[model samples]
Target: MASCKFLFIYPDINEFSHAYDGNNGCYYYGIAQLSSVLKRVGVETGLLHYTLRPAKEKFLNDIDNFTPDIIGFSSTTMMIADVYEWVRWIRESGRHSPLVLGGSHATLDYKRVAADGLFDVIFIGESEESIVEYCQHYRERPTNILGTVVKGDNDYIFNPARVLEQNLDRYPFPDWTLFDYESLYDMKTHKRGILMAARGCPYRCSFCSNDRYADLYRNKGKILRIKTVDYVIREAKAMKIQYPAINYFQFVEDTVGFDRIWLKEFSERWPREVGMDFYANLNVNVCNDDTIKLLALAGCRRLQIGVETGNESRRKEILKKPVLNKTIEAVVKECHKHDIDVNSLNMIGLPFESEENILETIHFNARLKPKLLQCTIFYPFPHTSLYDYCVEHKLISESNLSRTDYFRESILENPKISQEALYFFRDNFKTLIKIYRYVNIDWLIRLVGYKRAGKIIRLFRTRSELKKWLYQPRKKLLKYV
Candidate 1:
């Protein structure tokens, strides 16, 4: 039989607000690794990344040119609606190739995906080995594959569960050959290389998908796993050789410091061997003075830490991240001391969360004075604990659930806090932080606290002229020297 060819489709639709020239900072390592595995076995692979929705003809023409035996789609919860539309279009065009759906969405909601009958196979959890096995036996139409849910004559074939890959170094580095690295690197401001040194997060944050995904493979094996420090350094060196333009790397793990031993070894060797700065996410609950120092020694330029909410009780009870405010402050202080830039991630518009609570979050970030303050309207992703809570409270609007771009807007029908109020907070959150940071509001914050300070900022937020004057770019006048 001829070698099977696969086409990987990724819908990176960010609602088209940002530019999408096929390289807008969205890299799917799963698909890249899958392509590598296929190539190692002499199978052919192609990728059609759609940053924007394409015309039907364009989509069809690209597929026709490749003529892949299998078409696979990797999507997050945000891209599911668009994926459904594209799959339907493919079916309407009389294509007979087997369709596969994988990624976070499929792994978390395999039952729903299988019930839809849109895909011939739905891969759950890790698909690196499963995919190669599927391609090898696609002609046989076997249904007993460990990690797949395959379509049957009458119903779906639920295969036995597959275990997680504890040893990450078992597989080769991701196939960057599948992507246009030069174009991607050119579009990026930092010319950063993206790499994932680990597999999972240890904490089970309610709003995050990690907890839900972990429960899916409860008895399989250890959920959180990391590659050896030597393996990671080797990958980094190879990445530098492949793309000499890459000045630094961004390790895109949910949390990178869970294993301090692994981190210590990496920190010691990374700068000495690679000689480039890097950035990675750190859980505030896991970070300490020593961790920050180790990271700085490794040439870590910035660290992204989550400060999801300011209401301590809500953070613990609602979000399941039982970290103290003082703990967060100390972590930020250590990061600052080490000259590691901190980007604090926050969320607003949580269920049953009051305006004052949101203000507390803003005020809290201002106090920490992180180099970057990032906020997003809370989006209760499907299958997450928060999603179930929102559903139980009848706050979810099924009609408006189509869009998952929480950064743009909220879809909750929250009674305590209106969507309009949520929008107001999201729109002005950064500006409020700026006011607290630059302007003299320490007295007001100390005296009136979060609620009253929020009122004053709300008034300021309404005045566009004042905002424009405060933040407008100043022109550099030419002077003869």
Candidate 2:
């Protein structure tokens, strides 16, 4: 029998502009893992970054060149509309390869996606094992395969969930070579490396979809699993060899600093083996002075911590994150004490939140004084507790849900704050923080509010303009001297 060929397409309709910057920042790890698994079995696999080129032209060219027997797409909620359009075009263009859909969006909305007729098969939860099994039996009936939803003549056939891989080291390392490595650079920091040392999040924040994802594979072994420390070191060393230009590494995980034992092992070995500066996401609840010291010793230059909201009541009650504001402040201070930069992830326009709550968040962040602040408008993704809450309260309509991009605008309607007001707060949060820092008067800030406070800060714009004008000449004068 001829070996099966597979082509994985990552849709390009990105909500964030950074994805289109030809940087490997948007490389789909799911497809890369599947490619690694497929290559182990001697299957011909090709990956097409459809967003990096003309979608239709690239689609046609890849099909003509690779001649794949099966085409797979890894999609997120924001990319579903574009994926559907591309799938429709593929069918209309007279291609007959079986189309498969996977990833968070497909797994969460399997029934809707299966019934839409765009995908012949949908893999729920993890697909590494299921994909390998499906490809082995490609010539036979695949409807009975576990972890698959097959579109039958009358209806979709739902199969049992696939078991999660308990020992992550069993699988081959993700096929980073499948991507155009030169194109993958961090736009924010200008770094050129990305890796996922683990899978799954233990916490179930109401606004996030990870909890729902965890529920999908409840009995499928441990959901939160990490690669062995040795395996991680090996991959890191290999990446440095493959991309010599990569000076910094970014570990894309929910909480890279969660496991103390694993972190200790990684910290001790990473500096000796890899020796590159790195960044990671950390949960504030798990961080302390000791852990911060350990992370710094491991060559961690920056940490991204979630300070979702400053309103303790709203954060605990609505968001289900019981972390205190004081805890976050302490964590940030400790990280700074260790000479590590901190980036705080904050959100605005949450359900049942008022404008005052938003102001409290601003106050919280300003007081903490993180080196970087990322404030995104709230987006109620489907299958999340927050999404259902928005639905029950009618804060978000079905039409509003179509726009899943969190950065675009607020989709919810609160009686206390208008969408326009939310936009104003989000766009001006950093500037407001700077002003609050300069003034250092709490009662005055509360009295004037964000709008009037913004006006007050604008009075000093002349100084900012003058500084910009003097910057270039000052640099030249220093160089000559």
Estimate TM-scores for all models. 0.90, 0.89
* lDDT tens digits by residue: candidate 1, 60-176: 999999999999999887788889988999999999999999988898778988888899999988888789899999988878899999998899999967888898998888898
Inter-residue clash pairs, candidate 2: 23-183, 23-184, 24-183, 24-184
- Please estimate how well model 2 matches the true structure, expressed as its whole-model Cα lDDT: 0.79
Worst 10 residues of 2 by lDDT: 472-481
Candidate 1 error regions (>4 Å)? 15-25, 185-187, 437-481
In candidate 2, what are the lDDT values of residues 207-280, reduced to their tens digit? 88886887787888888899988998888888778777778888888887778888898889999988889999
- Model 1 error, position 359 (Å): 0.3
List candidate 2 segments past 4 Å from native: 18-25, 52-58, 187-189, 438-481
Candidate with top TM-score is 1
Worst ten in a row by lDDT for model 1: 472-481
Candidate no. 2 TM-score: 0.89
